[model samples]
Target: MHGPEPGPGEGMGRAVLRGGSVLAAGTLVERLARFARNVVLARIIAPDQFGLMAIVLAAIALFEALTEVGVSQAVIQNRRGHTPEFLNVAWWINVVRGVAIFAIAAPLSPLIADFYGEPALGPVLAVAFSTMVFTGLMSPKVYALQRQFRFGASVAITQGSGLLGTALTLVLGVLWQNVWALVLGTVFEAFVRFVLSFLLCPIRPTFRIDRESWRDLFAFTKGMFGLAFMTFVVAQADVFVLGRLVSAETLGLYAMAVTLAMFPLTLFSKVVQPLVVPILAAFQDTPDALRATYLRLERLIWLFGLPMAATMAVAAAPLLTLVYGPPYAAAAAPFAVIGVYTVVYMASMVSFSVYLAMARPELQRSFTLLRALLLVVSIYPLSLTYGPVGASSAMLGALVLAMVLQVANLRRIIGLRARAYLGTLGGGLVAAALVGALTAALGLLNLPVLTLAGLSVVPLLAVWGLLLFRERHEVRALRRRGGGAAASDR
Candidate 1:
């Protein structure tokens, strides 16, 4: 039921503030733990082995995307989504989707292996893909919690399970010293999430189906399924192209580089989605408020994302060498390119939550379709010629194009002011360029790895200082305009 619009004093705003902070902290912890695990594993395992694991992960992700029904989204959006009947139907759909993905993908593992020319991938894909089945059985009540904006339990469960899973990977990587360590960690993580899903959410879903609920969910999911495919292409097409055209060692290096390059974007999404998505959904009917919040978030994300993107782009080689050791140094070039791609992509993704909140999946779907088409035309030839660097460049160019289209659409639909939006983006570009130049000069000084990494933060710190100054000026303007301006800004 749509309740009365809750004000800041009524706890909704406080809940969002509190939950967003917790999710941010939790995501940071989880990412740090995973990063440490990867650093350790990279030392123990061969680049080629990591490459094989990357392919396995990509394949599993492909199947998961193919079978996505957007059940959580359906439950979150539907009127009676929290009821047992609706929850049960959604749960059952997830269960079936999971099984179907495994069934279909497992048999085709050999084909993927053959296509990639990695024989071991056949069995590896079958084993790794079983995580889908475990994930499929996760409780639908998790969505109920999300719909209610009660993120504490969800954050606790996910972060705790993620840490445990990362620990397991470290242990297994030390003992096994190969790709299976990563595979088992993936499976363990899924199983833990599946178990925690029920434990954290008290609403037990029974084995029952409701046709009406299913129809409602399907109504949302039918379009989402298509969007999922396009999303997959936008996300993993580079990996797919690189997997085919490059050596396993090269693919592995690219994977690690991309992982580091994507860290800020990943962290941004992990923190933002659980908080912002529900908030947007609640205010969807209030277009003015929604647009204001969306704009605020877009600016906030750019302010935060650009500095990190700049750091990664400029410091890719030293950062990779310092983290994963000298063996993976070749990944630096592509990593730098993809680092810029991520910030722009991150800016575009902020709008995605708005699309979902407004129930306009087709906007994002069209964006992703354009991106996928650009990739389809560009990735193969690029990968064929220039390998990972060309592939990364292509991905960057495609997103930039699609982002322009998306911005125009948002302006038409939401009265998005070009000057208002582009100001932050233009500022970000300036900050990123400054950071890049500073870090590059530092690199030329032949500093030690630890010194280089530490000194690289100097540029980022300068960016933050400038941002803080700008924020102060904005705050003063808001204060001078009186309480109503401050209220609107918030």
Candidate 2:
């Protein structure tokens, strides 16, 4: 527990709550748009189309991961004085890396197609390479804004562009009735992000590069670069493995499960991650301060994440039917597995952010590497034995191991009590389980889809409400303390 003392008006707890709310709102909008787009695509194209796209995207992700220079994170964490030269040098390096990735991936597309046994993949992959080039040109000023806690504007530009991209893709998919709509949508999103980043963020870079600036940023960027690469591998390993090992239709079903399981967790992480690093950076020097912030964050994460995971687990069948139709009913089991993992995945992510903020980025990188390794070891054997279902189980195992390691590492670093940590998780799990059981019983009785989905929401919301009610005193205390601090600062 070490970091700077929480200032009167700037407690990390309050900042996280406020920031989470803003981020959550933006994420909700983006997820909704994505959901709409996916619903349309699921209906228009065959499952094989998604599977094909998944395979091509996996290769693109790997190349993007390697070429990631991590200059954005470098900019965020550089508490040392920054200058125009630093931004300029980083920008040019990233531009170069982006170009290199496009060059390699474009030529390698044919090879990837050969490996996947799909000749059509070559053109699709070539088109996908453009996303990296556009994303590379995005201003690091966006990262700077995040550091300054100007999240509203950042959310507007990034999430708004994503919504527009999804809308455009859906429209195109309806018109063309093919995978090109989806591919074009992704490219459009990247382009919009690049344009909006520059428009909203004022830090423009000159073409000049400074040698000293490169050296100064290298230590931070190199470690983060490794972390980013590991992140991409862990995220995409399931898709990569399943696409190669299973049929396209099976891979498509698994992909949908992954999406359903990941969307909520991804949304939660996206909202919190940008805010956590800067808040943590500000208090990095004091272990006690960092410990308090970390505990508060973990609790906040469990509060929301556990409920969402529970709701998804309970409503998986009906929700899947409603959104993806009964043809995708096979995805329900895998969706449940991935939903369980989402809890651990979300918690570990927050812990990783705390570590990064504390300048222990190597630890974050180590954990990511471990997760990726576990994924490699688990996915192949499981896919061979149990096929897509086993692959989903492996993903859950990897996430759980990662979460346990993160919590253990945090405790080692700051001496957190095991009972306190488990209590929150156990309570949420129990509550969610009860709700899930109730929902399952209802499903067993042969209720209508709408009835099942509607009834499921009641118990889920009730469980969440009761949990919050029990914690009302703690929430109130935090608010009172935060309010008093703000008045004193004034």
Tens digits of per-residue lDDT for model 2 on 239-313?
A: 887777888888887787678778877776677677667766665666676676667767766776676677777
Highest TM-score against the true fold, candidate: 1
Tens-place lDDT per residue, model 1, 409-443, is 88876777777678667666777788878888998
What are the clashing pairs of model 1? none
lDDT of 2: 0.74
Q: Which sections of candidate 2 miss by over 4 Å?
A: 1-21, 80-83, 210-212, 468-490
Give candidate 2's root-mean-square deviation (CA, Å).
3.9
Q: Could you tell me how far off, in angstroms, the CA of residue 360 lies in candidate 2 after the best superposition?
A: 1.9
Task: Go through the candidates in order and give each one's C-alpha lDDT.
Answer: 0.79, 0.74
- Tally clashing residue pairs in candidate 2: 7
